[model samples]
Target: MQARVTGHVQGVGFRYATAQRARELGIVGYARNRDDGSVEVGMAGHDDDVANLIDWLQTGPSAARVDQVTSEEIAPQSWTDFQTG
Candidate 1:
């Protein structure tokens, strides 16, 4: 699924942390900081791993102060591996 996570998500290493966790879980996708003070993530993996990621993101990196999370199921896309954009 593709998730567009918002709120206090940038400049806090959120993307890197997400990439590491996703990679460890054997998930494939990419994450990037948006111009709108949000983080956009594209992940393709088992439901459990993706759910875990969504939950973990509620309280993101030490520097992050996540205030909200919104997820949506979308057509899955293939990625070579997890990465940060």
Candidate 2:
């Protein structure tokens, strides 16, 4: 799944926290900061785990003031580990 998280999502450890959560859930993908101030996260894992991550994205880290999280199913990528960029 691919998710775009908006609102106060950058420069606040959002990507790092997301990578940590994804790792704990055995998810493999990446979390990157977009130029538009949103965070883009790509996750591939068990359906339940992916869903769990998406749910967490709604609130994100304590410093994040998440206003929206939009997601969509996508072709799974061959990622062996989760990363923050």
Relative to the true structure, how large is the alpha-carbon lDDT of every model?
A: 0.86, 0.96
What tens-digit string does per-residue lDDT give for candidate 2 at 1-85?
9999999999999999999999999999999999999999999999999999999999999999999999998886899999888
Q: List the residue pairs that clash in candidate 1.
A: none
- Model 2 weakest lDDT span, ten residues long: 76-85
What is candidate 1's lDDT per residue for 1-85, written digit by digit as tens?
Answer: 8777777788889999999888888889999888889998889888899998888878878898888788888886768899898
TM-score leader: 2
**What overall lDDT, based on C-alpha atoms, would model 2 receive against the true structure?**
0.96
- Best prediction by lDDT: 2
Candidate 1 residue 44 Cα shift, in angstroms, is: 0.8
Please report how far candidate 1 places residue 63 from its true position, in Å. 0.9
